[model samples]
Every structure is written in structure tokens, then in C-alpha cells.
Target: MEWIILALVAGVIGYGIVIYNGLVALRNRVRNAFSQIDVQLQRRYDLIPNLVETAKGYMAHERETLEAVIAARNRAHSAAQRAAGTSGADAGALGAGAVGELASAEAALGGMLTRFFALAEAYPDLKANQNMAQLQEELASTENRIAFARQAYNDAVMTYNTRREQFPDSIVANSFNFTAAELWQLENAEARQAPRVSFGNR
Candidate 1:
């Protein structure tokens, strides 16, 4: 009976190790997914200044709209940087807050971009400008990439969260302090709507 007890204990210990390692791998995947999103977001931030510069000459009258986009972009970029710097168990609460802030800032930026594009409808010269057209196309591509990355990151987070919350794995995850990752989400309903712009007529 002593040998039987020893084998049962060894089996439980081995299973715990496996669960712990699986959680660690999932956590790493979540981190990698977040990094991908960070890269896309950085690309978007870099493109914004160029977009605004190209709009300046033709959008002189819409200065407020342009300024709002720049301000929101700056806020979002800063929040993203802060969130990227966070890690480990302490990162759980801090990262969640930072992610929430980033989402709000991004939503604000999206709204400003939408308004700016709407105003651009009246500026035929702006629509006809080759530089503006190119910038618009690049920004659209970056937006699509960001969307894809965000979805992937969220999916990873969902998997990690589920594992951490599962029965037997929960015991191992909690013991190892494997906190849940926050999912990326768009904060604004209006931002979900594609910007209403029609440059074809121009």
C-alpha cells in the first residue's frame, strides 16, 4: 500500500507540472499576440503624422478636426507604450487599466479620424491630391492589419483566461500566480462604423 500511495502522489505531481507548463506556454502566446498588435498600432501612429501633414494644405479650415486626431493618436500611443512595459503578476491589474485607457484613446482617435474624413468630402482638391490618396490607402491597410492583430490577441487572451479558470488547471495556475490577460476591445460603438467618405466623386 505504501508503493501505491507513492505512485498516486507522483502522478498528481506530474500532472500539476504539465498543467503549469501549459499555462506558461499560453501566457507566452498571449504576450506574443499583444506584441503583434503593438507593432501594428505603432505603424498606425507613425502614419498619422504623415496623413495630417498631407491634409494640412487642403484642410486648413478643418484645423480642429486634424488637431483632435493628432491629440487622440498621441494619447493612444502613450497608453500603448505603458501597457507594453507591464509584465508578470503585478501586470494583471496594471495591464488591465492600461489596456482600458488605450482602448478609450483609440476609440477617440477613430472618432476623430471619421470626422476628419467626413469633412474631407467637401475638399475636392484634397481628394484629388496624390499624396493624400496614397496616405489614405496606407492608413486603410494599417487599419486592417491592426484589426487582424487585435482579433488574434483577443483570441489568445480568451484561451489563456479559460485555462487559468479551469478546474484542475486553476489550482496550478493560481499557485503559480498566472493571472488572466485582458482582451482587446473597441470602446466606442460609433467607431465600429467605417468612416463615411466618398472620394470617387472627386
Candidate 2:
């Protein structure tokens, strides 16, 4: 009887250990995924200055549009930093509030970028400028990378959330104080629509 009771206790302890370790692993994966998004967003932010500068000379009439892009980029950069930092915290690890901040900021930035690109359509000389063309290409590529990174980050969050919410794992998650992660969402309707981009001719 003693041996049997000891064996049962050992089994429960071992199972608990496994669950705890799995939760830790999931949390780390979430962190790494957010970091990937931060890196891509940082790249996008760095490219914005060059893009704005290149457009300035030819877009003399659309000063507000250019300034809007810069302002939006700054806001997005700050939000991305906050998201990265909040994911580091234990209490709200990947909470909706933190990630939502980034999503909203990025959505605003996307809308501004769309407007900026639409402005490009009106400026023939700007379209013709090699620097502007190159910057546009780079920005598009960075956007693609950011999309992929966001997808990966969301996937990680989904997995972590599933593990945290499921029964057996949830028990471990609760004991360890693991919180649910938030998905990155598009908040701007304009951002959802296809951008009007006609760079060449009319």
C-alpha cells in the first residue's frame, strides 16, 4: 500500500512538471514571435524616413500627406516598442490591451501609407524618380515581411492560448499565472481596402 501510494504521488508530480514545462515553453515561443514582429516593424519604420524624403521634392503640393506618413510611422514605432515590452511582462504576457495598441497604431500607419501612395499616383515626376521607385519597392517588400511576421506571431499566440485555455494545461497555466495572448487585428476600414495605386501615366 505504501509503495502504491508513493507511485501515485510520483506520477502526479511528474505530470504536473510536464505541464508546467510545456506552459513555459509556450510562453517563450510567444515572446520570440512578438520579437520577430518587432524586428520587421522596425525595418519598416526605418524605411519610412527615406521614403518621405524621396517624395518631398516632387510632392511639394501634398505636404500634409507626407507629414501624416511621418507622424503615423512615429506612432507605430512607439506602439511596436510597447508591444514588445509588454510581452516581456509576466502578468499581462501578450494581453489584448498591449497588442491592441500596436494593432491600432499600425492600422493608422497603414491608412497614412495608402494615402501617401495615392498621392504618388498624381505626381508624374515623383513616379519617375529612381530613388522614389526604389524606396517604394523596398517599402513594399518590408510590408510583406511584416505581414509574414505578424502571421507567425499570431500563430504562436493561438497555440499558446490554446494550451493555456485547455483543461489539463490550463490547470498548469493557472498555477503559473499564464495569461491569454491577443491577436493582431486590422482596425481601419481603409486599410482593409485595396489601395489605389497608378504610378505610371494616368
Q: What C-alpha lDDT do the candidate models reach, one value each?
A: 0.81, 0.81
Task: Look at candidate 2 and tell me the lDDT of residue 148.
Answer: 82
C-alpha lDDT of candidate 1 relative to the true structure: 0.81
Screening candidate 1 with a backbone cut-off below 3 angstroms (N, C-alpha, C), the clashing residue pairs are none
Error of 1 at 21 (Å): 0.6
Residue by residue across 1-202, what tens digits does model 2's lDDT show? 9999999999999999998888888888888988888888898899889988988888888898888899999998988887777777876456558788888888888888888887688778788888877777777777777788888888988888998899988888888888888887777666654333337552
- lDDT for 15 in candidate 1 is 96
- Candidate 2 residue 183 Cα shift, in angstroms, is 0.8
The TM-score between candidate 1 and the true structure equals 0.92
